[model samples]
Target: MGTIRKGANGGFSGKAGSVIGASWKSIDYIRGLSKKSNKPATEEQLIQQARFYTIAKFIMPIAPFVQVGFSQINANTMTPTNAALQANIKTAVVGTYPNFVLDYAKVQISQGSLQPGGTVKAEVATGMLMISWTNKAIAIQNGQLDDLVYILLYHPELDEFLTAPEPPTRGLGTVDIELPEHFLGGKGQLWLFFADRKNKRISRTNYLGELDLV
Candidate 1:
């Protein structure tokens, strides 16, 4: 604790003590030593931090890809050769099925893809959910050919999983899976997996974590 001394002019100043004193805007204040506590975060803060951790895990690996894709799109104003790069970045930062027709096009100009993608944005369509990716086949030219893509759909409400064919390919591919009519208004997760065909090794996976069909 510090002491406050009254000046001869009827003002106040801090005396030399354990606390440091200063004046701001004509107000005198004391700065005390900081105390260290072994307090744990509350349950709510822990939950929120967990959510942030999850989001960070999802976006970290793909940040560079998104950044490059966004720059290419901005420079050319043409369709990016790696469209999935932009889509994946957008889905990670924002949600799924973002309105590319609206503010999404302006995302690069305004916010940019600097941060981890936002929450998952669910897409609502009639028949099929189309998942696509590129450059997997090119990896084979570098003697890394054993690459496979796995698409998984999980119905949490029903505790069921709908697995798409795990196809092995060289280059770009698209997987279109027909959803059941009953799942039209349901919620679930759509996960994308890239793995090695030989050891069933997974390189990386993108989780479109929470999907709501309408």
Candidate 2:
């Protein structure tokens, strides 16, 4: 039943038949009721959903990093995080839909013109995870000495992440991050990139591979 205050011709504010009457900012509106579909999903739809879920789960853990890593592509229509999501969907997903796996090597949490180190590696020492690289920004045409390094460790199984709250600059060439107490015996993937905050630029992510957190 619709509620009419003024008279029969007055605007309504409730359900009448198949449409819903409402108001926003004092503007009257009527819209068709939402309909539920009984049709089963097609194979393509199922596969697409699986890919989306797989990628979303992986990206959500380091969304803050993605926001900055993929910032160069942000536009009036798309956000940085969505841009990364769309990108990984095309290149990072592997295997068939039901078995879709994230190809870590191809996954890029951030994208920019800044050049990463020529060689990036990770190692576990004591209770610290040390990430080191060979390239000095001066050695690369696109790199900057002050470009900040985006280093992070991700436990896909736990959906937890560890990042340098204040990143080290390219000039340093290495950063030591203390692992969490629970991560000591666990394993996770390590990723790093270079970003120039002054120029609004970022580098392709470097997958330093998985490591034992010990």
TM-scores of the candidates are 0.38, 0.78
Provide the lDDT at 109 for model 1: 15
lDDT of 2 by residue, 79-158 (tens): 77799999999999899969999888888888877778777788997889888886554665477777788888887777
Off by over 4 Å in 2: 1-36, 135-139
What is the per-residue lDDT of model 1 for residues 7-120, given as tens digits with 9 covering 90 to 100?
554434554555667775466666775678789878767654554443444334444333333333433342332343344444444432222121222222112212211222
lDDT for model 2 comes to: 0.83
Best by TM-score: 2
Find the number of clashing residue pairs for candidate 2.
Answer: 1
lDDT of each: 0.46, 0.83
